[model samples]
Target: MIKTIIFDFGDVFLNLDKPATARELKKHEISNFSEAMLQKNREYEKGLMTSEEFVEEYCSSFPQLNSEVFTGSWNAILLDFPKHRLEFLKRLKREGKYTLILLSNTNDIHIDWVKENVEFFDEFKNCFDGFHLSQEINLRKPDAEIYEYVLAQHGVTPEETLFIDDTSENTKAAAELGIQVWNIDPAKEDVTDLFTIKKDLF
Candidate 1:
């Protein structure tokens, strides 16, 4: 019996524009964002580096752009977390039908942005019994360790959990570990759509 519902934070609970960083860099006359630059950003996401450090390193390399501006631009991908999604998750929590969890492969900078911008961070945190972040855990999706860690921590059986994520690769990884997953397209569907099809989830 599906007892847990895990949702990915970015591109699922909240909006994330993957291309925003490259776009923002373009505005600063940084036309060539090398693969190495992207790797640095991912390392930050994995908690291997801090946001302040990232800004310093990036600004040092660019030398022309202000580090604060770089920080804001790096954070531009984080748009708004709509009220409806928060309400939906809260409703599910109130129902007490499933163990609601929020899992995301995210970083310090983006989290800092959310803490500052999303006033309801406490409310959102209150809704989830388990909030697993890749950085804090030092484990990320597409790797079995993350899924294994979550399942172990929650005592949840893979067959009895439904994982929803915006990234195709992430959902695929969870599914490989035996958790039912939905690779949702936010631009194509919304949160309400999941509840409507809940009966077919198992």
Candidate 2:
């Protein structure tokens, strides 16, 4: 039986145009997302590098682009958070049937946009018993250690938790630790359908 629920925030909740950032950056003739740049992104996500350092690296790479434009393009992937999903999460919190948690791989730049755009960002967050942000925790998904950290922190057994994420890699990592998972496709499904879609697990 699942006593706890761990959720991923990006596609699972807030809609994201995953390719928007790359597309926008390419327009500025910054076509190469080199291996080093990818590594830097991973470091930024893991909170190993501060936002100032992260932005500086990109600025140095593309001296032609202004910081404001670079920041805007970097945050282009974020989209709207459907109000219905917020209601569904609120209902779940009220029921108190499970310990709800949010585990997201996010960075400061993206989070800043979310806070400003999502009207209920604060309320939506209050619904979770535990909230873990990659930048804040210095950990990220698709890594076994992060999952282990959440499990240990909550004192929840893998078998007793259900982890929902839109990324297959992330779900795969969680499953390795014996946790139940729902690797959702945001294009075809919505988080609000959790009860009906994953009824077997519930």
Candidate 3:
């Protein structure tokens, strides 16, 4: 009885190399960010800080890098976005199978990069019933509150929602709220596997 589909953008749709940016920054000696630094980065994505502020903080941590290098280092995380996924999602939107929503933990710098790179970004926004970015919502995934917020905002029953994500922890969070979920691994299974898993529903 799932009446809605929730998706995570990075690993679920676009392919992101989590290590790439950090690795790239390592060359610039800004590579040694601790878990706390990562947590702060997530805070920025959760709309707790602006891109300029986030980059400045990062730069302050490593004064050797200029603002340009910091921004480049930040953007390296978003390696590539494929066209096939865009087409697939567009098809789903056209089919009107369910209430489609994009719930991603993303920030302004990366988002601005996407807008500049992807020709379909504007169209992709139209595909979703609600396109909620953690940076915009001030809430990030793996947090129970964000999931609850989306559920309440959409009037969606937990049992009536299916969430697709690349992170097991993220899917687990949604599952905890009684939503069905799929954890897709790009290195192992493709996002298209979601279609096979949910074939009956479609």
Candidate 4:
């Protein structure tokens, strides 16, 4: 039986334009992220670097772009949070059948944008019994340690937890640790149909 539910924020609950950031950057003549740039992004997501520091690193690399432009492009990945998803989550929270946990790999600037743009952000956050943001916790997903940390912190057995994410890499990582998962495809499905889609689990 699944006693706890772990959800990924991007695409699972909130909508995202995954290519928007890269597309935006290309417009500024920044076509690709080098390995070092990617590492910096990972560091930022892990809270190893401050937002200011992250922005400065990018600005220094691309001297033509200022902090504001880079920040805007970075945040272009976030789209809208559909109201129906929030309603489904709220209903699930009201039922209180399982321990609800939100585990996301996100940076400060992205979350700051979410807080400002998503009107019901606070209410959505309150639905979770445990809300673990990667940057806030200094841990990001697709890593065994982060999943272990969440399980230990919440005192939930991996076998009794269901992890839902849009990324297959993340879902595969959790599955390897004995946690059940749904690697949802946002293009074909909506999370509101969770129960029907994963009926055997329920």
TM-scores, all models, native as reference: 0.93, 0.98, 0.94, 0.98
| Candidate 2, backbone clash total | 0
Model 1 lDDT per residue over 13-56, tens place: 78888899879988888878679988887787678887778888
lDDT of each residue in 89-186, candidate 2, tens digit only = 99999999999999999999899999999999999999999999998999999999999999999999999999999999999999999999999999
**Better candidate by lDDT, 1 or 2:** 2
Top lDDT hit:
4
Model 4: residues with Cα > 4 Å off, grouped in runs: none
Q: For candidate 4, what is the TM-score? A: 0.98
Residue 66 lDDT (model 3):
80
lDDT of 4: 0.94
Q: Give per-residue lDDT, candidate 1, residue 98.
A: 93
**Model 3 worst lDDT run, 10 consecutive residues:** 193-202
Q: Give lDDT: candidate 4, residue 126.
A: 97
lDDT of 4 by residue, 37-76 (tens): 9999999999999999999999999998899999999999
Cα error of candidate 2 at position 139, Å: 0.6
After TM-score superposition, the amount by which residue 138's alpha carbon in candidate 2 deviates from its true location, in angstroms, is: 0.6
RMSD of each: 1.5, 0.7, 1.5, 0.7
How many residue pairs clash in all the candidates, one count each? 0, 0, 0, 0
